[model samples]
Target: MTALRPAPALLEAAFEAAREAMVLCTADRVVVMANEAARHLLPSARPGSPAPAPLPADGADSFQAEHEGRQLYGMRRELDDGHHAWFLRDHTEELARTTALEVERSRTAFLAEAGRRLSASLHMRRCVRTAVELAATHLADAAIVVLPPERRQSAWTRLLPGLPVEEGTLREPQLGEVPGLLEALGGFPPIPSRWLDPSQAPGWLVPAGFGPVGALLVIPLPGNAEPAGALILARCGPAAVFTSEDEVLARIFAARAGAAVSAAVLYREQVDTTAILQADLLPPELPEPEGFELTGAYQAAREGLRIGGDFYDVFGPAGASTDTVIALGDVCGTGPEAAVLTGKVRQTLRALRLVHTEPAAMLTVLNEALLQQSSRQPRFVTMVIGSVHRIDHGRVQLELASGGHPAPLVLRHDGSVEEVPTSGTLIGVLPRTVVRPATVELAPGELCLLYSDGLTEARGGPTGTEQFGEGRLHQALSECRGMPGAVAVERIRQLVSDWVRGGDSDDIAMLAVRAPTRTPLSLRGGGAPAQSPYVIAARRGDRRPRNF
Candidate 1:
């Protein structure tokens, strides 16, 4: 046999010199050899029984091996011979770094999710609670507090786990009360009090038996121009010092929190203001038409930090012997300005009734007034005006004039919706123009629906690909043919709300009036004429004055 020139011993010595633990085992479960690293790692290695089963079959060459209290790793390879070799490598430091990375990733994910939740939440209390919990669990051992402008004491406070206990502590300073601190820091930037030793600062005070405070982090809750409140954190243990990295993360979180709070506050205020203005602008109750029962509802868009301009008004007289008129309009903007304009339009329409009796003529006059008033601004208004005249017997005559508004929808008793043929230019665009009002004869039980653009312009579907157009409105009205006007209006509101998924981009105003056939006068005959008694009385009384 050719001499095997001591290759096995040399190879064994080379393997022993390597830093990685090395072991060679035969297929029959007998240990062929083991290097110094392998010997050091496994003190019990004689001729191993199974060679620790070649690290898991996956391609990962290195993995942990927890033997006793210490952690290690075993890398494996198949030798040129049929034997298998395992190289042991300690991985304690690498594992520590990987664990830290994973923790940081989890923290980032948690913060992102918290921000989304805060943005979506409508209730301020719940949002504040959730935010505090998120920061306490993920960011640091913090005490979150929110203070309202009216509340002399702090708004709320949530103590994080492991914080020093303070009982009945009702007084805390809000950022509004600390203008000096905020101005000193320039725009209320976050400041770390940990740098100043707790014992050195005169303001640092510890509770009964608690140890000296380790760190303090103060962040201001910002609003339109100034800080609204302050977020104060107190730490106790040696590891509680607020680091620069911690301050950076806190500032980011504070920014999101401040924005969410500001948005919510603004939304609530706008809603209140809009509701008040809309209620004030619209008449409390519509005048009863001679042959009609009127029911109406108005809704503002659920968007932005402003109120919209959608309004409905009913003028003229009440009862069977009276002429009832209805008007619905939308201003082209949002917020207090639009609300102001809406109020003006309603007032103008009401005032026009004193001079004009014709619906089209009254709209024309109001249009001129609006144009004169809004000449300096680059906006216009759309309106639909209607007058109901009780004709002889149970029949009623409806006259409608549209100014760049959606055509009124008429629902017949037979479940058919007809888009009324009424179209004209928007008001406030022309200084003087003739408005031709369309006339329609309504039988008993027929209903008319007048609405603004909000219902027709709602974005549809998951991607907002479609709009709840005029066709959809017609379909919805047709579906509720036999329902009462009040019920129908409610259903329409519900349908619109659902189609928009609680998100509306524009303001919606709707008014529905149903012409009832039977008159109270039919039960009793001495009733006056359907024409205004005041006008007739005035005409009779004016004969002597005209003669003079």
Candidate 2:
């Protein structure tokens, strides 16, 4: 405010002409003269009376008070003749504006914090719990969040101060018993607080031991396609009745909580769907035939996902049959998209087995079937499909067809690894894609190995970029000369894993089929030949094969 002083002659005219209310007083604290504004502002302070209480106390220079319901500001200014003037003005509008600004700031901060806390929850139940807890703490005396009904029951979470949150399923909630709840649950606009009578609230809507309700607020938590649920807020006494502004803030808060709960519900649905997908796409347990042991290992390229491009399955022969169908394949890429194609290939092969089970014939039919897909983008699968047969004299024979896949390796009894020459054109591409079929014979102590390219192509070494070539894989297998099928497969997988050392990798899969070796009573050549540790473990029933 600008400095103001009045000339003795012009003081009365200045005080009267100005809009400000001014009262002049003597050193004795007695009122001497007053302007029209001051006379109207303080009707009781006349020329002969003392000043009113609106004056600043304790010799203060300024004061603020309420006069006849109007907010007033007063200033004391001293004059040269042992007199002073009290300048007063109505400042109701300014103070109200400041108070409103502060209230808005508080509401904004509250909403921001609420949004942060709500969005952090991904589980639907936890999100509901958090919503009710927050509302109870800040918006009302108690709160409850009710989810959509299912199976003739509705799930609810409720909270109150100094008490653990409560949750349970209510059999057929009577929403009509509570005013505005049915409308809110239907996603209609909320009803004003004044319209609801606390005494009419249903007992189930209020937590136990809580006194009579003062106010109730019900609002829907909207979702992407439908309402996620509804929120119920209550106050304990008449003094806490929600104002119009309080209702508006509650609505805004409900909007944020609704969005968060909706997202959480959507995420949970996806997780459930993914679980089903993983169960279907996961490789089946490899069947162990008499005198034939098969073990396999698999790891998807995408972390946290169980299904990937690489896959393997073993179908044991029916009664009296000697051959067990084994198929291991890798799609072009290494994620869900490729895994889908891998699944299609596996299912198509199973379906085609009724038509033609021969390795080459099955490949031909699968190639034609894949080429018939409706996808615009090209997709192909590299596979090693074959059958394991336990022949006479305890030897195993393997007949397989390769479709643009890495050649299979045969581990010899003397620790020598030989690669089978069965590389062919990748399936799902050329209609006349060549299918190269090969045959290998495993001696009593030998084994046949089928694997995906993720093994030899794993990238890591001292330089962290070197590929674990076939030479390293072969050398690793040489160490597992007399090990069981599962042990050999695990050995190869472990070596590849070490080679990568936690670096990015493609989908890896390996399968090994070993012929049983004879275990003798003595270490010498007296009875049967000395058995390997794997065979001893097998006899002890402790050889647990890896789950495919």
Candidate 3:
């Protein structure tokens, strides 16, 4: 015989063998039939009893409930004769997976937020405070951060839930008060959180009135090449405790905080170094109370640097009749490389002047001294060295020599500008370099300007490519005829700055020496002689002070 179909009544038996729990209920809400699965899924399900409290209300068909300890999910379908069949299955594993997924997402978001807030600042105080605040809000009731020691003392900051942050430095001896803290600061292997008794925390580590301590952890802050600091986290109450996952997170956060703090420290050190170098390279006090009134200006080619290759110094005896040497030099290159040579050349000239005070003779000795440094790179120098002396009340004589430097310009009181004819071989270049001494004189109320080529070689104009040139400088000097040395130097600098129009420039250095003009005493009412220039400066209506 062919395979015969099961009778309609056998379908009822098929329902009994189903894996999911099935129940048949009457219109009166009484259970008519309960399968084996239903009895195992919900212990309360039985024949002739009210269908499990819910029975899938008026228009809805699906429901879920906790029967005993198992989760049951069910749905209802209408059947013939005012009867209904309810089907349910256990879905505890699926529900558990969904909850786990949500938890992972939340943790990922927390880490992302931590990174964003920590990277926002390069300041140590802000970074450490941020780290502790974040840790307190998420990981613990209170947090503390300790920085590596600079000498004998280390800095630390603490934060409690309701109190203001407290920070101070602690000595090395104080570190022994806490267990595992010194090791953490040393970047030793992680110490298990369980080993430290939270209840026994040091008074200094935890703020006063912090009740009970239930958990404690210490982690090292990582840096570029070494440990930058350490982080401490604590919680209150016996129920609060740290897990392995929490320790990993703390280490990661500490690393980020440490890097930011170390970077800030590095930046501060670099700024301090630059400031010291700037102070050292700046021109010192010029030869004052001497025959000539001197004023100088200097600018570095590099944007942030204060000194390049150009330098100037004046050294000698202090008297109107005595000779004083004025040396302004330019090294072969630019920036630090050239600036290095500038210092060496200046120091050599300073020491040699003790033996040879004569202008040309001192330069020759300086050349020889520089060449003797066989270890140094052979860098050439262009300089104007002059021995100045006040010959009379109205004139100052300058015995000058050039070492392949720009010719000095004299701005006469008649509004005339002329360059002194002085030229020679470059200094510090050859074993035997030629130097010739030349003499010039500055009349009262007149200036003799010595400048580096940076003043004339600046490239900027209508097209931003043309040099300022000597012709323009000559015309500019003419307008400074009667102006004092300081005023003339400032005026020339302003002109050059304007010509460049914010373009990059080489090191510009200018030294202007002017002979004081003698003014006759013109008293107002035959009462008192003329007041000094300094006194005139204090009075309003009086002209600007000068080298009178």
Candidate 4:
């Protein structure tokens, strides 16, 4: 049997009781029919205004319509009668919820990406720029990062290991600006981020090409106790203005960005401080005397950027050109205490230079000074103090004295290396010293190298536990004859560095002095050359400060 279709009256009753608004309009824009819900929902659907267009065949689009100043979302369908049937629902709430969820997701992801970008560099400016760019891309049309003056305390605030302990003064605030939106923001404070009402925004804001609507947020960047900086975000009119929720998210982002930027600031300050401290602890440029070529290298232990106690210096007597002094010494230990003792030892030796003519006598006086000083902890020092005097055109005499230190190496004019046989009790270890001067005359193309035990004692090899022995040092220097003083020093430095493979090691200090193969042309001529032609002077590139 065939099923009977529903009567027209039954269909009409069902349409009137339906929840969705329904309307039937002829193609020419005249309403042919309407349900009670449709009439109540869209009063204009009763007759002609303009018929809503039919929905896309794929049903992938919705049209927004306004009735009674309320927003509506619906679709239109083509009926068999050549008319259009419009089906609409009150979607304002659902659309609001979905848009909110999407925005929330975007914000979460943006913050995560911002964190990654901010932490990617230890540079302060880069971190600030990352934060501003991220805010502009996700939170607002424009953004700004403003930093307060740097704190005065040591940059050792961060608890993380492997960070440098540096200190630097930040005198002015730093600000980061977004690419656009200056017009909307107008004039911002030079050092701080502050909010402004749209109506009262500075004159430049609107003229600067900021968007239609104006809303601003100034979120203070949180630090350990006080704020390190502030973040400013702005939006134009008609756009979703700043809401309390937006402010909350902005504050959260500002907190993380602040931490990263603060850390970067601390790191940069520490680096600078470390450089200054090392400069003070290490010898300045090696003195360039007519008879000698000098170069040196120093490396601090891996603990941090702070300088260790190993020290070296080459200085000439006040006005005497014929004789110069060379000193290399290591205090009993490392860290600030050793550094202090190193400085004291250097000062004591410098003062003793005037009174003592012999290297052995000078060291005897230094030993007494070391033993007399009162410190929280007792310290001893091993040192080699030598007096270099020009004997003739092609020869130089080195009078050396050692106190419990490695014997200085001599790379002779011939392809041979020998250690100066000098030894004595360590300074600060005995009431009387046993140092005696050991004199050796250096022919042209010979070098006298004094170094700390750090080089020969660095432990790393195939098994990662072998000490770099004097045998290796001897063999290495054997090949360095006739080389520039700077080249010879660098060869040893590179060799030790490679052997250690960047592993933990003690401080390394080296000083090499050579009698040039040829007398400086300036000495032969009437006056000194404008610049030394020695490759030793040219390759003296190690003077550039080391980064820890």
Candidate 5:
């Protein structure tokens, strides 16, 4: 306050020597002073010229502005005389660094999203296509190729954008040359690439600016622990060097892709194997029976992993006879265990037939044997065994026994359907229970139908709980009355299939027997005296008096 001393010119000159641009302006936008940098930026600075338009206000200390296409940051302060002093700094390098960081962040976000989408897709073909598209879009590759394992003379090959590949043109990879690349990536196998030997590479190189083939990734697909296929990726483009990040990403994606392809191939193989086993278990065709015509069909349940135990057998004459036997049975459970039980039951039943003419006795013996031989597993079987005998002309007798099975439906010539109810508990439930036989007399042109529970228990109708019960079955049988046994059985099967509409939860086994209108004896006798029913005496254990 004593004597105002003018600022030294040296102070101004020293400030001009600094790197940042500096300037001084009055509140009314008048140029007062400027540093060398500011003078260099303008090139129009005069000793006392007016300041540029849009001068900064007092206390606006930090802000950005553009000058001659260059960005500048500045701070302003108020002077004692209501004037303003502004200081400017160039921020070009800082802005450039910030922009580069943002770009990298966006790239990382895109790669993360792409990887998630690739892993989530369940369809193998769609996942492969998406991966290829990702490589082409992000990695800037010239082409992407995937080769599956060799099968027969050819391996499966798919190129991105569907590049046309000539038949038998793709060759297998040589693994020995690329040991270093495979060793660097743990658990990754080498896929033979055509470019390994420069001479074998395609003539079409990438454009001049684009780079060489940077890397090849190979992944092995193991199906049920057995090598089933492989996935290969070829990357080439400008700046196409494979970074450490790329190797990590490719390794993860390849593992996921290999697993998906393996699952699909294994599923296909299992389906084929099951179908073959089912075919082997089923009979080629039922034998033609004589007075009574017989037709039988067997089908395995589709949902079960193995063939079911539903089976039908017609033994003896097709005609009505005291000895003709028709048997339909369903063993408990499904698959291999049930199939083995079915074989045992069939063998036992056949053996019992030699000693017992009555169906009930034969079933009792079979049940006892099954209970004794089978493990104490909670299992049982349903069966319907029937014997047809001709008593006199125009009369055929049917003796039936049911073991917890659906009663056989009898279709008469008069278009009426009747269910023949037989009494017996399920076999293998009670070791010594006796089965009760029911008898029916068949008239000329009448049919008898035997079926497993699969036909009646099929889901259908409203409530989604309604079953194709006995009523529907009877109606179907009545509709097919007087038809040939083979034709009638086939119609019944079709009607059941339609009612179920293919919703068969269990296996179906059916057998149909129809007494022919003409007697077998009449056919053999040539309209003369009929011979007696052929008799084959069964043997019994000798019971001579034992020595005391």
Candidate 6:
């Protein structure tokens, strides 16, 4: 018997049982044959009905087609009977996997770039702004950085395409004003992360204007002893709920920003403290004794955190109406400790003035006091002290004493400069201080200048290594013989500041006392004073002619 051909019904039944979908259609695209898998994939295709769309006509060619809500990949073949045939496979699962991988890769790249931008600045405000922009752009619809109440401000930012980044500050709120914020501020992880509708958000969160938030994350920024602040990220509309990966990124960014802000805050505090301390150490106001005009200038060393040890003061005539004391001194070092010693020296002198009227005697007692403390503190001072006693006709007698200091210069009315002759070992050393006293009469239109070594020892020139030297200081003073006391002090300060190119050298202190010009009536009856021409020329802002 001849092999029997498999019946058409049996062949169709085999097709129905196969897993792959199979469809047979005429060239005109009418479906004539379809297996159970094919009918399940495309319910719209029936025998004697047109195919859903044109079938692929080449061998093993793949094309996408929709069947109900499912996506199918079709492999087409041309049958021997001139009908069009296709093998269909469901591809929706594979497509979803690929798309997810692409999204994850993009997010990873975004995080790395965000981190770089955030760390680019150590400035507190700039770091906060960078963090806000990054989060709003990549991680959330809206972002907020809320500083602790002590910090006093908050920042908000959001992602709105085609618009500029929005940012502003809100005054920090009291703890009781917002629910759950305190817990977050305590460094606790937001449990299940906060999810709230926009209308229900706390007042602090309202500035961000995140519409209908679907998920919110509150992460604390850590500090050494406490939480520095909180970072709030909110997603709105249909954005995906924050995942574990997102939480990790938020914590990292906040930590970096928090560190930078804490450093800035601490730096500002240190600067303010330094300013107050320096102000206290320096003289507040100069003493203006009768028959005298006085001015003083103090410059701290410009180099470091330390204010220098140079100091000056003018006070008194306390017990003796005719005597006023002026002192300029320098301690051995720079910094807060040296500054403290400067204050001690000034106070000791002030106290000594009440008991001692003579400059030499007063300095000897101060030396004893410093020597007593030397074993414990071991510092010395270089000083020049003067007592001005008024005499006949607008003239004063200066009893000057020096303790290992640059001698004071007396710029006389006749344009002659003289160094007061006084000398001794620096104070706070040697058991007994030997201070030599010299007396000079400061006539009308004369000035007495007392200064620390910073003026004479300043290093500068064409080579920038030479000391400004006493000769230069003398020349500078000789030019201002008849100027007011205040003008003389300021001129010297400006010269030294310019000489040093505003660099940090040693601390500088200067004090000047000027006597007023005498009237011709007081010049022993109609005799012209030697100071007359210079005083008149100085008042006109001009130099005196040599023989006038």
Best candidate, lDDT? 2
Candidate No. with top TM-score: 2
Better of 1 and 5 by lDDT: 1
Supply the TM-score for candidate 4.
0.66
Per-residue error for 119 in candidate 1, Å, reads 4.8
Tens digit of lDDT per residue, candidate 2, span 1-548? 98887677796676678877888888777898888888888887788788876875477899889988879989999985789989999888888999999999988998988999999879988888889888998889999888777897788898976789999876765757777777776788888888888789888777668888988878888777788888888999767699999999998889888999999989999999888877768989766578878888999987887889999987766545557888899998878888888878888877765544778778888899999999878799899988778765567778788899998888877787888767689898898978767776666778888999988888999999999998998899999988888888887888888889899999999888888885444643465543232211211334422111
Question: Model-by-model lDDT, in order?
Answer: 0.67, 0.82, 0.79, 0.70, 0.63, 0.74
What shift in Å separates residue 200 of candidate 6 from its native position after superposition? Answer: 3.0
Error of 5 at 410 (Å): 2.1
Query: Can you tell me which runs of candidate 6 are displaced by over 4 Å?
Result: 1-138, 150-174, 194-199, 207-210, 238-240, 303-306, 316-323, 335-337, 351-358, 372-377, 501-504, 520-548
TM-score of each: 0.51, 0.88, 0.79, 0.66, 0.60, 0.71
Q: How should the candidates be ordered by TM-score, best one leading? A: 2, 3, 6, 4, 5, 1
On the 0 to 100 scale, the lDDT of residue 529 in model 4 is 30
Cα lDDT of model 1 by residue, 237-274, tens digit: 76668777777777777677766776766777887877
**Colliding pairs, model 6:** none
lDDT, candidate 3, at 68: 69
Which residue pairs show backbone clashes in model 3? none
**What's the distance in Å from true for residue 481, model 5?**
1.9
Residue 507 in model 2: shift from native, Å?
1.5
List residue ranges in candidate 1 displaced over 4 A: 1-123, 151-153, 159-216, 222-224, 236-252, 259-292, 297-311, 316-324, 328-344, 354-360, 370-432, 435-548
lDDT of 3 by residue, 1-548 (tens): 89999886797788788887888888776888878888777667788877775455564688887666666788888897689888878887788888878877876787788888888877768877888888888778999888888799999988898988888999988887777889988988667788888876788787568877888898888776877788888988888788888887777777777787777667677878877866756676775855679899988888887779998888876434367778888888899878877878888877767665677777777788778877557888899998777865446777778898998988876787877667778888788878766676676677899999999999899989899999999999999989999999999999999999999888888988888875544523344433322111111324433343
Off by over 4 Å in 2: 1-10, 66-70, 80-82, 319-322, 354-356, 521-548
